[model samples]
Target: MVSDVLLGELAALAVLSPAAAFAALGAYLLLLRTPSERVVSRAVLSALSVSLAASLAIWGSAVAAPYAFVPVKLGHWFATRSYAFELVLLVDRLSATMMVLVSLIALTVGRFSVAYLHREPGFARFFLLLALFSTGMLALVSAGTVDLLFAGWELVGATSVLLVAFFHEREAPPRAAVRVYITYRLCDVGLLGGAVLMHDLAHSSQWGEVFGGAPWPGAAASLGPGAATALALCLFLAAMGKSAQFPLGSWLPRAMEGPTPSSALFYGAISVHAGVYLMLRVAPLLQRSPAASAVIACVGAATAVYGTTVGRVQADVKSALAHATMTQVGLMFVEIGLGLYWLALVHLFAHACLRCLQMLRAPSALRDAQEIRAAHAGEPLPPLGLAARVLPAALVRRAYWLALDRFHLEALQERLVAAPLMRLGRVLDRLERRWVAALSGWPERAAVEPGEPDAHAPGAPERAMAFEPAASDRKGART
Candidate 1:
């Protein structure tokens, strides 16, 4: 949907192209993907690069207006009940900033993935997820509703899970992917419930409609403050899950098992920022709930302090980046909590770009440092040895150790999620055996084959077959 507006067309490109390119790339790579190569991955990377440029142009253009502006629309059929309000690519100040941040991060990480995942097994798969993530990020900014925005939000989670387990042969990658999924699912539930509440109250799902004072169909013109606040809390809970805020905050640190490109793209930038994006998207509605806003602020502040402290303890390059992402995200929450939505957008934008770069570069930087240490054993690399001015090494070390433990959330997961699953699994196994036995017949028994010896068998080798000539040969001989 190109428009007379130069900015709108660009926004359309950002919203639509990445998904299309990735889908095409995915198709091409289906025949070509192997451990040795991933054809056309580069093209998807280039698409994201172009998208990043477009995103920035739009951001710069839209930043002039603080409230919503830059309108463009496209419609798609999502299902029978609801027709897609596809793209109303509005780049009000908040969305503009988010667009720039997401595109930049997607572009940088796309570039990094090219080299880092070259000749790696999941190259095409990685690009597919990455491209989809890029598209979702852009589309999310373009979304004008809780529904459309959620559609985009879901793609981010789906793609992130695949990216997290990109190196599935390893033990850790699978575990990390599962954990990310579990947390994301929980978050989605809250988000969906809140969306229902919003629709019930506002009569329409569109952000403009709900916050702009449209009531739900057949509903009253006025909603109770308590109801609005409840909905706000529900949305905030979703934000906490997606953003890695307290309690739900621990998943990001363990998500480093994926390829570094994913570490850069999903965890470091767009994926982690999804929560903040949601929070900012509903800023108008959330503003009505002072209780919700205070909670958001409290969680964000706590996460910032906790993440920074824990980040001090991380020795791994990716782990450090994960912690950094959490710390910055927490700061963004602070911005949202404090009513400085636009300023938070700036932090989200700036931090996404910087963190992606930092994450993309970290592996090489650490390698170079290691090389230096090897080449000059006794000498200090002055910068590497310096501790943060605000926090000393001792405290950092202590915090790092605790952070490395992720405050034992893994153990808590076993109690809350895993142990129950294990018990359920045993029940399933029992059910399976009973069902299978009940479901089976003689065919199944025959398929199992008789382990028992035949009655004719007597622990002796069977007699060799008697040699016999063909009947025609015998007749010919007789004649």
Candidate 2:
């Protein structure tokens, strides 16, 4: 067996490498020092490469030994009267495998971006965010406590929104970023709520304490059914928002407004799969709650069907690919619900790699299509299989229309959820405005009686009479 100290060092390196790179690049950019594109790319890739090596070594040692997981604690971050936070990191089969994938994909994406965005404005900014994302993803995968995971989760979300707004000069990118940010905030409630419940139920935020100290993929859950159900539901809400399940799915396609490299890394590879990884990590909790598992299954199935229908009718390649990614991620969710934990992990890794490749090559799609047509002597390609071959003509037509409209899911969301929230927001704004006006004395001016003469009005009798008393009093005092 490897020494515990060696393993701890390796784990620390795996988490810190990308963070160090992020810090260095961010400092340089903030100081307004222009860094060469090659230097930026190399720095980011080198850090990720180191992280990948450390993660692989850890994974190899764990496999050689009898332990299913290895954990390390750097130090305590802070301590409260009731709760103490620690800077802990863990590596198991799951996290190690994901680390390898994340580093490799990031390296590829970073390399691609160095050229794809050559001489473009914000080139340094792009690498900075990419490095930040790498750090966040690694931290999240290895986090030993819900509190730690939440911190990593937030970092990933922030970088994602920023990447979506990479083209800040464009109107669409900012709008898309805002939409995604709103969705993230709404969905984050679940993660925060779940973390609170976990602390209350287990008396600790550590994964080991919460799950009875068992290794992942085989946790002996300690939380009761009730607690587990509530926690899982909260997490599911978070997952739906992050993974773009069903009604929240519109933002995924709109997120294509960013550069291709960002698009590939985020939606195709890392960010979109974060929620799935979270669920897999907490599989034991879901296993304990039948109600939560049922909800997960139902939602996964609905999202998968929804993604397929919408993907079929998307006019643009990127949008179509986004929906397709949502479909596969939904299947992964189903696998988790069915207790096929390892299968879900495998699916996530495989799908992420494949989708990233497809998205990266999307810009050349027209050229590829032309080549294919030429090879086929300009003949039209045959249709792939149809789902409604035996259905009546009218029914098929109706289904096609529904698919074209993405089943009206976006409209439903705006009407049922967004509209009510927007109205509530306006009402709150109005109330706040009135409160401010009252505090600033505007309300008193607005409340002036119409019959009362204006104090400053020219030739007003009331104004003259009001000043005459004061003037006479001053004169009497002087005399």
Which one wins on TM-score? 2
Where is model 1 poorest over a 10-residue stretch in terms of lDDT? 470-479
| TM, every model | 0.76, 0.90
- Residue-wise C-alpha lDDT for candidate 1, range 1-479, written one tens digit per residue: 22337777788787777888877776766765442343456677678777878877776665444343544656654545653444455656666667777777777677666777777666667777777888887888777667768888888888888877777777677777777898889878988998888777777676655665221111222446687678878888888888888778667866777777777777776778888888777776566667777888899998887787677667776777777788889989988888888788778777877887787787687777678888888786566434455678798677666666767765687678767987897677656655675677523333222233333446523422332334421110000
Candidate 2 residue lDDT tens string, 254-364 = 888889999999999988999998898888898898788888888888889989877887778898899999999999888888999989998999999999999999988
Candidate with the greatest lDDT versus the true structure: 2
Note each model's CA RMSD in angstroms. 12.9, 11.1
